[model samples]
Structures are given as C-alpha cells and as structure tokens.
Target: MNYLTVLGLSAATLTTISFLPQMVKTWQTKSAKDVSYIMLITFILGVSLWLLYGILRQDIAIVLANAITLVFNLTILWLKIKYGKTRPRKYL
Candidate 1:
C-alpha cells in the first residue's frame, strides 16, 4: 500500500474507534440525556453524505470509515431517543 493509503486508513481507523467509548458508555449507563439529539442527527446526516461521497470517489478508507461511523451514530441516536424523554429538559 502507498503512504497516502496508509495515512487515510489510519485516520479512518482512529476516527471510527473514537465512537466506541461513547456507545459503550451509553449502553452501560442507559442514559443519553447529555447527548444532544440535534448533534446526533446532524452528525448522522453528515456521515451519510460522506459515505456517498466516498462511494462516488471509490475511496475504501472513506467508505469504510463513514459506514461504520454511521452505524455507531445511528445506535447513539436510538439510545438518545429511547432515553431522551425520561430526562428533564434544560431551558436556558
């Protein structure tokens, strides 16, 4: 593999793995009150777009990273929706 490919794959790996801790924490705690619904929604949308972009570009690294990240983002979104109502809202 070329240096650019290696770099892309490495970046993809790190960014994808970064979501794991948050997912595990939300799963264990069963509390996604602090996770913003808007943020999750926006992120999921962005990831989806990135996945499409990657597919168009035929970039394995981008496709794999965004695809996996989308799964994680969706999972967190589900958790947030499931647990969101139980928590009190913050009004500023």
Candidate 2:
C-alpha cells in the first residue's frame, strides 16, 4: 500500500478502535444515561455523510473506515437506547 493509504488506514483504525471501551462498558453495565442522544445522532449523521462521500469518491480507505466507524457508533447508539433507563441494569 502507498504511504497515504497506510496513513489513512492507521488513522481509521485508531479512531475506530477508540470506541471499543465505551461500547464494552455500555454492554457490560447496561447504562448509557451519561451518553448524549443528540451527540450520538449528530455524529451518526456526519459519519453517514462521510461514508457516502467516500463511496462517491471511490476511496477505499475512506469508505472502509467510515463504514466500520458507522457500525461501531450504531451499535453504541442501540445500546444507549436499550439500556438508557434511569437505573443501570446490574451486571452479573
């Protein structure tokens, strides 16, 4: 791969991986009240747009990165909705 491609992929990998901790925490604790609905929604929208842009540009790096990030964010959003009640579900 070219330098630019490597750079893009590396950046994408790091950014995407950053969400793992939050995802795992939400999954285990079943609590997402601290998470903002607006933030997540807005980010999702932005990422969706970026993904579309990437697809249009035919940039594999942009497409792949945004696609994976989209999934991560979506899953987090789903968990936020599912476990966003007043009290966190106890972890066993």
TM-score of each: 0.90, 0.92
Which pairs clash inside model 2?
none
TM-score of structure candidate 2:
0.92
Candidate 1, clashing residue pairs?
A: none
Tens digit per residue, CA lDDT, model 2, 13-87: 898888889889989888887889999999999999999999999988899989988999999999998887557
Candidate 1 C-alpha lDDT tens digits along 38-57: 89989999999999999999
lDDT at 87 for candidate 2? 77
